[model samples]
Target: MNILAIESSCDDTSASVLSGDRILSNVIASQSVHIKFGGVVPELASRAHQQTISQTVEQALEEAGISLSDLDAVAVTQGPGLMGSLLVGVCFTKGLALANDLPIIGVNHMDAHIYANFIEHQPEFPLISLTVSGGHTQLELVREPFDHEILGKTRDDAAGEAFDKIGKVLGLPYPAGPEIDKLSKQGDPDFHDFPQALLHEGLDFSFSGLKTSVLYYTQDQTNDFLEEHKADICASVSKAISEVLIKKLERAVDQTGVKTVVLSGGVSANSMLRAKTEEMANRKGLNWYAPHISYCTDNAAMIAITAKFMAQRGRYADLEMRPFASV
Candidate 1:
């Protein structure tokens, strides 16, 4: 079946066309207005989505060599994101469904992240997924397709959030996770040992303490000192976060006895985290999977692929369905 998917759960307005499990095209319109604000502004994001969603979808369809009438169903991210931003996609999708007499599939943003790995790889069942993003950090046990048991999640700030917050203290740009990852490659991870909160605790994670630690650590240093050791600081912080995430994932694997492990969400794009996950999986003789970098961040291809699974299960949404802000 051919599917048209829209993703506007955050600052990006994206659309994708999928046939079976293959993505023909994935188009994203990112809003630069939030860069100066250091984070996404809900109002601005919704406005940008409204402005670009139509054209984004058009581009996706054109690239796919198909039109709206040829689509079998329309899918969209329904929740676990900004309400206004979600509404832009949800309402727009509803209109298309109504006009073309097509079925509407409502997808969870987090769920889409997990399934994004399926776009290129066929991971075995009964797997553990470590989903790390700016808004969430979670360990999910998937016993089968679309069957997820959240093993643990962040009690406070997520891993990606920690990266950005700490990066800001180091005077990096907004959405600084990628920046930190790049700089860490050239520095020493052992330069400074940042606290890894709840490292020995339960499956739940915490990064708030780490954020505060970076804040205080930077305050005590002069600008020249910070500039001189910026890469080291970034490397150390990345080490702390990656250690906590990998440790928790290891615990989940032991507790669940799952041989296959997958990583998803925006933070999964980090080079250090990917390498650490691969190393741990190899040491344990387990299977490891992660999405291509294109699917790591927010995108409609994940939504389209996830919707294909949902469609198989006869999960469909009606016009009365409304957008939600949380899971």
Candidate 2:
């Protein structure tokens, strides 16, 4: 089956084409307007999506060497993202489906992240997934396709969000996760012991306290002091987040007795987390899976792959379906 997928869950407007299990093209247009604000501005993001969605989809179809009439189904991210952003994709997709008289599928953004692993590495059933993104951080138990049990989720800020917020504190650019990850490579994670929140808690994650700790630590430092210690701060902060995530994931593995574990979402791009998780998985003799760096962040390829699974289960949606902002 040929499926076209659209993902505008947040700041990036992306489209992908999948012919059966094979991805033909994945196109994304990222919005840079949020950088000045140090975060995504929802209204501006919505507007950007409006302007880019059509062209993005067109480019994807062209790159895939297909026409709208060649598509068998249309899939779109339906929720757990900015409402306006979600609406743009959903509405545009509905129009496309209507125009082509094609079947439509509504996919959960978080679920798409997990299925991203399917794009390259298909994990066995009953595996564990640690999905960390700017808006969410959660541990899920995957029993089967489309069957997800959220084991634990962030109580406040997500791990990726914490990275960006802390990066902002360090006078880094917006969407600071990548910046922090890059800087952490040059400094010592032991330079300062940033607090790791809820380390003793169960599987649930917490990063608000860590962000607060960074805030308080930098509040009294001079600009010169911050400049000198920036790399160390980034390294220490990265270490703190990575430790908490790995600890909780380890706990989940012990409790569930699942031997296959995977990492998903945007934060899966972090080198430290990837390395540490690989080590833990090796130490425990467990199978570990992570998507290629390109698939680690939001993209339509994951969404299209997810739609392929939904298609197998006959999980198509009607045009009347509405987008949601939360899972």
Question: Pick by lDDT: which candidate is best?
Answer: 1
lDDT score, residue 91, model 1? 96
C-alpha lDDT score of every prediction, in listed order:
0.95, 0.94
Model 2, position 299, has a per-residue lDDT of 98
Tens digit of per-residue lDDT, candidate 2, span 1-327 = 999999999999999999978999999999999999998999999999999999999999999999988989999999989999999999999999998899999999999999999998878998999999998999999999978899999999999999999998898998899999999999899999988888998989889999999999999899899899899999999999999999999999999999999999999999999999999999999999999999999999999999999999999999899999987
Q: Show pairs that collide, candidate 2.
A: none
Candidate 1 has its poorest 10 consecutive residues by lDDT at 162-171
Off by over 4 Å in 2: none
Judge candidate 1 against the unseen true structure and give its global Cα lDDT, from 0 to 1: 0.95
TM-score of 1: 0.99
